[model samples]
Target: MTSKPEKVRWGILGPGNIAKAFAGGVAHSRTGTLVAVGARNPGKAGLTEAFPGARILDGYEALLGDPDVDAIYISTPHPSHAEWAIKAAEAGKHVLCEKPLGLTAFEADAMIHAARKAGTFLGEAFMYRLHPQTARLVELIRAGAIGEIKMIKSSFGFAMPGFMPEHRLYAKDLAGGGILDVGGYPVSMARLIAGAAAGKPFAEPDEVVGAAHLGQSGVDEWASALLHFPGGIVAEVSCSISLAQDNVLRILGNKGRIEVADFWYAGGQQGGTGEIRIIRPGDTEVVEVKEDGWLYAFEVDAAGEAILGGKQEFAWPGMGWADSLGNLRVLDKWRAAIGLEYDIEKPAKRVNTISGRKLRAGGTAIPKRSIPGLPRPASCLALGFEDFRTFSSGAILLDAYFEAGGNLFDTAFVYGSGYTETLLGQWLKNRGVREQSVVIGKGAHSPLCYPDVIGKQLTQSLERLQTDHIDVYFMHRDNPDVPVDEFVDAMDREVKAGRIRGPFGGSNWTMERMDEAIAYAERTGKQKPGALSNNFSLAEMLEPIWAGCVTSSSDEWKAWLTARQMPNFAWSSQGRGFFTDRAGRDRRDNEELVRVWYSDKNFGRRDRAIELAKRLGKSPIHVALAYVLAQPFPSVPLIGPRSLDELEDSLQALDISLSPDDLAWLDSGSDQARARA
Candidate 1:
């Protein structure tokens, strides 16, 4: 591991024109020093004369590992930004990469996640934002220089006199496009203005729509986008490589307008006059922002100070983590609107994690347990990933889970309207971990609950999941109105037909019905329910969490599960945030938490869990999850984590071992006297 430095010793990854400009800024920086320049080949020529003191490394990898370097500035083309940024973070080097942060928001998210996992700094290099001029502009707008802001108009475009296919600006293979290149400037500024109007660091567009003309190379040449923000503020942003635009920023309000020419560059690298013009109906006011600081030096020092200050991100005026993510998301939408997709965004190219490394063997292995009829043991903790909308988003998380020794995924026919299943399938195929993984697919949910609909929905689910057989299939909801015989026979037919090749069960089913189905199955020689998926948490459910939910936390139900020894693929295993501090009695904001896991008995259990957690040096939520894992029978708590932090937090339970007495006290407080001993 690299030691922290008082002054950030910076390394330039790609010594191109942008890197040279930034090096000039570093020469003027207060808290930063240029230490090394890394190139593709072993050349001591171009960058050395520019900076006589800096060493020239043979390759980017060498620079990343250089003991003298404290941080890295990635000035490579747009395509490699995410990859190198992630690699730098993995090497424990702070990263400041040129924008856009990634070709798409998904890549941006992965880069951010990688830095977080590595405990390093990662920032998008938008030097304009770190300049004092931007702060003043925001301050002026906040002071109502333009009262009741209504519209924003900004453009950053330049005409390439000759559109050579090999040029970085026009090359399709390089992810060349107006939206992904120069367009981020106008969009980011618009968001900053919109955020100043509303009271935040930055705001994402509520709606984005755009149109662009694709060149012969299948990349967007020029594009225009309209962003609708909150409070009826609209922003018109445009960019191009082959079209000459005014390169101006205009913020119009109800009473006046603020205008700036070439706002991004401010004055020049050396700084001259950055004038902000306010034009009212009858008068014109000019605010001159003048400083001798180099334009890029401000960003270099900003990153240096943040790193030395032990901050993972830059302050407001500069793009924070969320701010960069929001900007990239808008760019993604704009590119999507214009049908601009880079070759890298395709599934064929996105098979690996953004960090290009597996997350397994990270010192903690997710404990695995065997399920009936599976070829191999699966993780005790199952992941329900229904929130991701894109393949990259889902793949990143899935990759983390799979590499962490988690081989069970909970998916459904109705998740994301089948898009979730499609993404999971893509991840399974991409990762080639299908046979090693257990997929719990649920279908025939409420409103569509029928014996006959199961097969049809299962077929569609199989197709979406790109698998012919589901390892662990379940009926999402039970229909008592439909005879248990029909349900059992239908499931048996499917089992015989090999649609469900592993454990088959029912989710949200009553214990009485499950027993009845098992009896019927045994009597008729059909497949009996192998597992159950119900709400089984430390806190008992008082009311339904959702429309049709069942809780197996009752004493009788626990006794039944213990006696039968059936593995329950429990949902909402963390009590749906019940054990968390957010579930206090006074915090009734979450009606669902109040409705389902909000009784005096459950609160008493929560208190006991908290008390035990304090003794165990863990959180009440961790104790709650540990209680589930220590059940008398097989209990695989289905955990849903949207990000790496949440996933790591959930994994903390794997280290907590709750004995039978501890579990008894957590469940009923009967063994508390012995537990404390």
Candidate 2:
């Protein structure tokens, strides 16, 4: 690990109260430094009134677009976080967006995806979780100091009746509400505590019930929610702006209980000064842990390290985009239960027309299975590992899939820095399964799209695969401006050079483009693309993955594939897990993922999938995979499983056989019914 600096360069977005205090905290930190201030009005930045020598920028765009700005700290309103953070990530800047990363989980996923694509860092700025004292509390709780946690109670509120309702804190248009503003703190803490009890980084509540006192501004003035964990751990949390609260957190277990005072904004007005106490059964004595100084500095350090070290997201517990999304999903429900609906949650503002797809909260790892009837491949290699360099898990997943009669390994040069290919190479070497297996490789992914990249990436991939040529190759994207002849000639050259053999496919390309390419190839006497790799789940895309790129799943595209006898390696065959409602909402960074993977139509499909899963005695995820595998044409679904459990669940589609009537029924639901109202 690289040693943390005595001071990290920091840029602040928006000049709000949180930003002010955060800047102050950074000024006092021995390991952080405030470098720039980005506000809508340059004159209003007033950095001289806070931290001297901190330059003020004219706008948020300038802060992000500036090459000198190493990392950005977004303290803007919730709605703006998603827009600005995405722009920042695209500009190659690391981001630390405020709590509740975006209004929804899909938004957070988009932000994460953007950061991943950019090779930058991103994290929800939940300063309190990073306090040294929070870690100590978790350590004690994990050590059984609190003994099997069973219940939790926490609250954060303050009465300010005389305050104007237009302030950002009370403005519904700004996503103001007790749940998002204050409830998030306690809820995050509960998840952290619950996850620690189960030896995981996080926990999804099984159920959430909410009630709130609404302010005239239409936001939650006071709100309370109940969270049920799988292992009998139930937690109650409350927050309010119209009433004073204890701002305390307490957890009860079989053998003991733990409590924290002022849990959300733990540190005192100036910085860290919060306290936690543990009370064991039959012991009146209390053991307390004290935290010192402003906690936001830790978030700054995390973003700094990620940017300088090239990490996709922060490693802190209870502070990832996923955590933020989970917390918001619960909060959205709690607010709804309380009749505290922000303008943002209104039907007009949501991308999906439906109200909200109900989720099965709670950490229930139900076994997921794939439906049967996929075209017989040489073998089904599990092309699912995320980190290909890590031999233990990656190779283990491959072996597990191969041992189960799967012999075709799918990979891309862009995956894991060609680490996936390297791992596959080493696995082949170790098992001597090279000739027995078929290799599928893809290239030209984001950030690596040079035409020359095809040959260069292919050569490196072959070297890593320990093979002279690939059995199947794919153009991961289509450059609309790069004429058909150019692409065909390049692939044909590779085929003739013995670098790639047999068939080639197209991913993220449209039918017109594919048709043109094949036409060009046929006229020129070169091999045309023999496969299509686009998203072909039960739910199709409403828009292109990116702004300009279109998916090759339209009728025309499908017809082209069918006409030419081209098989499809359907990317996201399981609708990217949306059929199970596993695909979350948007976030501040990875917006593209949210738009492409988790739209309203997809959510609607997932809602129906869940109902069908329950009716069929199968997991919703399995239903989704089955839907993908049920396609009429010759299709091979690409699955990204992180563990044996996920791999097994994704494989459930192998057995399910959805009739044409069943598929049509699913696709033709009240189109409006799919709208998350």
Candidate 3:
């Protein structure tokens, strides 16, 4: 028994190039039908004249009111993509909004909210994602065809100087620009290939630094950026609106590389033309594919199946609204870095949804007032963390932090066994905000820092972070065996490759070694480390607390910092919760940490912290955190808060101010200090 293919009647808004393609696509598809076309003016009504069987309405509202239309395909200029889509969704029409999903994630959020409220299906028209070829590519990568994809290089752009101003590609009012116009293709492709390592598309580029060739209208006609994905997969993505390129997409892995030709959405142009070339260490083969007729048809079918099944959006794992938002977030950052702003999005549209459910950037108020060892006034949002678990709290906290006003983030690869780096990668997605954020990445720790670990770990860290480069990368641990020159050379290579953004630094290294590293970079004509992340605290440690622990809390260290212009992001700025009493002195209970950095001196410091905690009418943790924030240097403490309550509790210390005398009294002769005396 053969079941009849279900038909989804579509109402297309805006009679443009995309609309015609979609109309022609329905004519060629088996699962959907185009029933109506809407135009803003009668003069432009000719845009849909080819669809003789379908009615052409004078306005979008007329088309939405048509009972026969089950859905609306939004092919309007970029600026109107969200508005009309939300209207259609509110009218209970399934919506397939065109790519660059919306002018911003904020706009996209509105449309999504409306769809959810109206109980309608709303999907971003990322036609390429629905193509059979893209599906196969995902399968190959997931199957490890390219063992552990470590890097991806892709580009899509073309020159168009002779184009008309009314063309959406050149109109600022249309939200036109290379990044949002064509950048979406390569950026989205990068997200597809990076997979779970990135956790989401638009892996919050740990850092997005780039140069652009701007057009007469101030739109980026050509721009280049590097996206670092988790586990060391770097996607060097570029795009140009004014010139043409191969539009090649390549995913580089440890074992091989996967290259796709003309990887964007191509429907009915060439029925069966492109090939995906797989090149291995020793073998090379080109796999060909036939377009499954119309590319948009697949999404139409997916939309139909989803709506019929009572889902608000397509449930495809990677193509969900979350993924769409991620892509937009990255695009948002790329545009921001290049100074590209669309006038149309100046005052973001109001939420039409019942929740008045607009997307608001969360986490307000700087956490610096409460954090310690910070050298400068805290930015709106500063991402604070230790080691790799980069994405999890660091990334999640950063998102919340940024929504609140944070702009700085810190990370090191060895912390989460790379999981942290991976997490950071996920946090950086389609927000059109990169320049405003601060990223600190570290390399060379554990099973890795034997000199041989430098290059691979840094590259891997970049990929995990999901940006082309690291804003600030550090040497996680000093390897005495590796000549300082060797370390400098490796980092120098990345600097040249444009993999590490300006302002590099060191972590867990002594001041002497840091001086040696800075000298080596200078002598070699390479970039010098600009920041330092060390065990700096309000309380001092006399002797080694752990087997390999290092601290730069000495007065000499402060003098050195004052002399050097380098910035510092303090680690364990809160003294490992020893000051908070959240961590008890009984090592038997917390063996893991006790074995790492616990000591009798730290316990004594903990006792004094408790006393001070009482005097301040604050928690020991808050006093400890306040102590770190009291430093005169430009420093920020890396706090580890597991819940919002803890985060809020930590945040409460922001208003607590300590005097220089208070600092002196707390540290002058605490038990740890007396022992040293």
Candidate 4:
């Protein structure tokens, strides 16, 4: 905290009608003052009349650069919220963006990340959430006035007289829709009420389902969604621009129910009285909230106080970071269920990262090395994001990787049952970085592990990836029953046909099987298997991690890999939490870890790793990863980092230079560099 200011100087960006309401609210705030109004054309914007005595800055960027502006109130179109909010944070200005902080949860997450990175306050402009009326409602719910809430129903809607295709509410390119506009009022309230009933700040719905009437302009004119929360509470929410709704909120419980008419306009904009009625079998109660301040004034003050307090976000009851993220996620799920996606979220429109940065090369944290079969050099770590469900969520990490000089991605047909492949494909296509990327595609795992299925699955994987060829392909698993010729012959045809441009190998094939396949390929003049993906780490696997999984950590297997100079795209390169102190001989809670990695020898190796990590001034996990990277052969470790922090943590291994002696000591507390002299 630098110093608490008497008032937060505010600048309003995109001085439209909403800005008028917010600007009026600023006049009523105790913690804020109007500094400037930012617009594209300062001369014709008429800021003199709309916001008299306020400086008019030409262009949004000008406001961001203004040293006098302490905070920015972004009232831009829905699609530009993420852009302006991030830019403001980067420019060292606090951001209080208009509600529905972003069109999607991904955008909200990015905005929050930027705020956190910059140490600036960021808030969603949900005025009702900060109003005293909302506080009283929450207080009543928590006090059990409604007697164990079970259900909530709310609506916000109004009719547009005629079809106005070019209107902001109907324009597809502008991200015009009822759900993104007003649907959040009920959803946010429902979550808040549910949280109050549960005695928490907020609660997210377990499931969100919706139905929308898509107008001719391809925007949701009216929509209704159901949010199912934990403990059997349900919320029914609706919003419309082409039709009028009651615009009321109702909470139902076992003993009684509460109703608030026009809940969204609580305190009535320019300040008046708002009523909440509680009804029971034979008794009735009414709670009236009175305030003399404008509605948006509460939000402005809330943000100002948070910034002045050196906090990065508003406290509960206000739309905090997590609350805003949860609300946007609910909105995303609702839109997905109703198949209401705007053009901007599509691949064609998302040509850059949400940060709006185009990926550039050569500022690498993870170094690149050549793989025999890949057309491009593979990063020391092949990113495995097999759990991603959406493009926006996954692309953030992908963009970070690409910008950090990572060129390799690992995916399989079996992962997410092919959704992972599609997501990877969408990310690559949207980012337009396929030419510089090394894609590791895998197929034919388990129940369908056959030579013929390899080609078929490869075709499907290619289509899902939106690519004509795979850089380095692999059969996800090998079938011992099938002849080596069948597998060798099948993949050879793919390579010859230009479908597999790099080396095609097996993910979990045994050493003997791999050697036999190599011999068969050489004898038949076919493309030879050039890589093996097995579990390799400081502590070797004692048993199969998966049904057909293999470990190349044994002495003979390592010797063969070293002699052949074949690359091992090792998965679980860091022993899958073996070096993390949480895993030990006493702790057998993880059955897979116990079943596959537990042994007296492995425990000694783990201890030696901790000791060596101390000497190297790094963590045991970093030492474990470095051991894999510093292997004698062309070994590329595949790291599956689930978040940006984890990705950065994995990159720490690249900096640790592990010599052969260090590797030998990490593998075992051996006096000799090799297992035996």
Q: Against the true structure, whose lDDT is highest?
A: 4
Model 2 residue runs over 4 Å out of place are 1-7, 267-274, 290-292, 345-677
Candidate 2 or 3, higher lDDT?
2
What do the candidate models score in CA lDDT, each in turn? 0.87, 0.70, 0.68, 0.88
Clashes of each: 0, 50, 62, 1
Residues 1-677 of candidate 1 have per-residue lDDT tens digits of 96666678999999888888999999899999999988896464656787668898889999999988989999989978888998999899999999988877767877888888888888889999999899999998899987989999999999998778988888877899788889999999999999999977777889999999999888889999999998899999999999999998999998899999999899888888899999999999999999889999999999988899888888888899899989988987887687777776566777667676543433237978787777678898999999887776677778878878888999999999998899888888877777778899999999999999999999999999888899999999998899998998888899999989888889999998999999998988888999999999998888787777899989999999999999998888889888887899789999888878788888888998888788878898998898899998999999999877678788888889878887777777785645442
Q: What is the lDDT of residue 54 in candidate 1?
A: 87
TM-score of 4: 0.91
lDDT of 4: 0.88
**Against the hidden true structure, what lDDT does model 2 obtain?**
0.70
Give TM-scores for every candidate, taking all chains together and pairing residue i with residue i: 0.93, 0.54, 0.52, 0.91
Sorted by lDDT, highest first, which candidate order results? Answer: 4, 1, 2, 3
lDDT of each residue in 38-108, candidate 2, tens digit only: 87877853556875778888888788777567778888888777667777888877778888786655456
> Which regions in candidate 3 have their CA more than 4 angstroms from the true location?
1-5, 43-48, 161-163, 196-205, 265-270, 347-677
Better of 1 and 2 by TM-score: 1
Q: Model 4, range 329-445, lDDT digits (tens) per residue?
A: 899989889887788877777777776767677757777887776667778889999867777667777877878889899999999989989998998887777898899999889
- Residue-level lDDT for 460 in candidate 3: 83
